[model samples]
Target: MVDFFTPDQIAMLSASTVRCDFLVKFEFASSTMRAWNGNTELVVAGDTYLPMFGFGQIDGLGMSGGTVSENVTLSLSGLPGQALDLLSVALDDTPEVDQQMLTIFLQLFTDEWQPAGTPIPIFRGFMQPPSVSRSAMQGTEGATQSISLTAENIFYSRSRPAYGRNTDRDQQARSPGDKFFGFVASLISKTITYPDY
Candidate 1:
């Protein structure tokens, strides 16, 4: 009979190293739907970290068999008006503007000997436009307004990340075609074309 746990599995479970830090980057959609060939790093002034963040596993569906989708929730504290303006451009009310998407990259690093060791990407995917909300509470001390961004992963695959437009070259290169762009384009086109024809 085969053993329940393998040597590699035991070693991995008993590993002492723990993840200590994380790095997150966001890429907002641009004017054109062609493809993203530019840098995706978000530029912020001074030091700023997402106060609250969570990604992966959609509740009860965690153990389900079908295609699994993930979600990301980010809370930004003391967000400046300038940053909000930039985000507004990406996530707006108009149909054309709302089509814009966000690419989020999250990297996790283990508590190893090296201070600058390479980080492993834990989650990376194109997220639907965030549902943003601003809340202000008045207290005895003062009032605070915080902004929260919640988005769902557009594609389900963990190994393959979905970003950029689907090109003819990309379609021909991969057997299954680009998962992210392919699925989205088909869904959107179907919605738009169904009523027209």
Candidate 2:
């Protein structure tokens, strides 16, 4: 619902010639992979995004019924042999909560292939588990592999509990020395009645 475009990015939108690229950052356990659905590698904010045609498409980002979806689906594909190595990352998500998955909209100027302005982050969320699939072509000698990653919006966490208890013991477990909630538990069963005037 909120517009995240800068002045320059806004101006670039209504220009005569507008070109845009999508940059996807996948933060994994061992390494962070930066990829762009572009013809060539691009460097934005000093970070290089590898050219990857496998960033097939992104869905669930559009508004529906005045609200955005909680999860966005990212489709990626490559040779069956490589599979973009995303399958491993997907499988690694079991023991840990996957890190932030960022997707930015990079506006490119057609004249010299330079950026119009600072890129705008279109999708910011943590990636859930991914689903991988493989299929063979009718006449091709090799097969293609694809993975669908569901990126759960960060706002979805607001509906979940933080697991914090309003007790001195619980507070001490977290801070070890802080007793901010020390009196909260004792006050639960004690009721102070007001005297009649």
Error of 1 at 146 (Å): 2.6
Off by over 4 Å in 1: 1-19, 30-66, 79-116, 154-197
- For candidate 2, the lDDT comes to 0.65
Predicted candidate 1 versus true structure: per-residue lDDT over 80-124, tens digit per residue: 333224345445644433324543322233344221322323444
lDDT of 2 by residue, 1-197 (tens): 33467666777787987877667777765677777666667777788777665546788775332112377888877733342455666666643325455454555565677766666676678777677888777685667678787887766555423426455666687788897876664553365666847
Highest-TM-score candidate? 2
Please give the lDDT score at residue 1 for candidate 1.
37
Question: What is the alpha-carbon lDDT for the whole of candidate 1?
Answer: 0.39
Q: lDDT per prediction?
A: 0.39, 0.65
